[model samples]
Target: MSRPRSYDEPSVLSGAMQAFRRDGYRGVSIRDLEDATGLKAGSIYNSFGDKAGLFDAAFEHYNKVVLGGRVDRFAPAAAGISGLRDLFISLMHEPNGESHGCLITNSAIELDRDEQTYRHVCTGMDILFEVFLNRLAAAQQDGSLRAGTDPVLAATKLLALYQGLLVLVRAGRDTQALERLVAAEFHELETYHDARPAQQDIQA
Candidate 1:
């Protein structure tokens, strides 16, 4: 019979999650995880089954606690562009005070081997796209967007924008520069001006 664990599962996973964020999948070794989680190899193997299992747990934890948590803030913001701005600003902050980069985004670049991980990331992105697409449609209805602007296209652009920004942050771009870049994109959208003037018929 196996004895109950002395270590907390979530705590161990949370600590390993931080190490994964900092070292990345390929960069981190079994020894690295051991150091981060304070669990011996046998315990890790017995508790989580393997490194892959441990990583899968950690990835889900990061999504819910770090990345997905940002979406909860959307309800309070004005929605559409204002809510999007708040979301973008939140991305600049690191998860658990580790500025390495998004665990999902980082893992995304190395997802050639793991089907389960890839599916999770893909589903997460699709959920994000659906949420933003609806928000963009709402903005159009409220006249915050151009009368003829395509909500689908705008939402896709936003998806690209945030993902690209994460890579830039990982590349060590200056914080001021990152903020300025965000400001420039928002300024180009002219969101500060009153909702786009209604379109008028030009027929004679």
Candidate 2:
């Protein structure tokens, strides 16, 4: 019978993720992973196949465990505008040391030439955009957003703003500045409501 796995896969993967997040894929070596994960070369190879394989595993873990929780916070917001606002606020409030911008956005910048890695990153971005689009559509239907607002366009703009904020935060932008920037964008959403009649506002 095949031998059962001997090490703590989740723990090892979490360490690997930290290493990968600190250094892009090309920068992480087997020795680095070995030190980070406390797994010998042979053990890592045996379990995960190669460095790329281990990175893929770590990326998946980070996505589900870290980014996933933040995204989940917006899932219950009453409308797209609220959800988008909440999402930006969460990013601004992210703990100092834990703020590394975004793993997927970093991957996108570092792995653009690698088709497999690019595709994986693109899929994650697509899911985020789709979620925003769906929420925006719901807002439009309920009159919380203007009737003529293009859900896809609004989603794209929000995504750009969010990703840009991530870049700014990673560069050491002040937390208050980030908060103000996000609040300003959210305030613009109110203009749409202002154009609607008072009765429509009550229905929203």
Candidate 3:
């Protein structure tokens, strides 16, 4: 009879994820995953199909566990904008804050568009894009944002900043610097309600 599996799948995937995050797909080998996960080659293949399958699994884990954590509170329309900000705040302070950047962003740049791993990367990016889009639209309705603003475009811009932060972190940029830059951007927002009282007085 086949021997029962020895290790916890989730735990193993988590370790493998760190390896992938630290070293891109092309950089890691089967032996590297074995060292990272403490599992034999046969076990690795039996559990996940191949290197690509294991990567896909690990990428999804990074998505739900790392990126999607604490994101639900911002699901409401106006709250999503806060959610976006909260996400970066949490990211800057993520445990083991070091050279490791976002797995999805790294994979997006490192993996081929036609590679299987690319789909997960795209899916993760889409999730962030959707969250930002929802929040921007809500802000517009609530008058927190100025009129004539396009939520779709604004969300894309926010996503760009976010992705850029990931790169900066990998390049050893200070989290404090990122915080200041983000704060400045938020401060520049011209809320519609900020001008409301003046407009009413003018009408009077």
Tell me how many clashing residue pairs each candidate has.
0, 0, 0
Instruction: For each candidate, give its TM-score against the true structure.
Output: 0.81, 0.83, 0.83
Error (Å) of candidate 2 at residue 48 is 1.3
Assess candidate 2 and give its TM-score to the true structure.
0.83
Weakest ten-residue segment in model 3 by summed lDDT: 187-196
TM-score of 1: 0.81
Query: What digit string (tens of lDDT, one per residue) describes model 2 on residues 1-204?
Result: 988977898899988988887787887899999999999999999999989899889888877777666677775446457767888888777666676457787888888656665666776678678777877778877777765678888889888887788788777788788898888877765346454568977798
lDDT of 3 by residue, 1-204 (tens): 988889988888888888888888888899999998999999899899998889889898988886676566534444645556667666577567555667888988988899767888889889989888777777777777667778898888878998998888788789898988777665544344343467768899
lDDT of 2: 0.78
Order the numbered candidates by lDDT, best leading.
3, 2, 1
What's the CA error at residue 187 for candidate 2, in Å?
2.4
lDDT of model 1 at residue 1?
90
| Cα-based lDDT for every prediction | 0.76, 0.78, 0.79
For model 2 the local lDDT of residue 173 reads 81
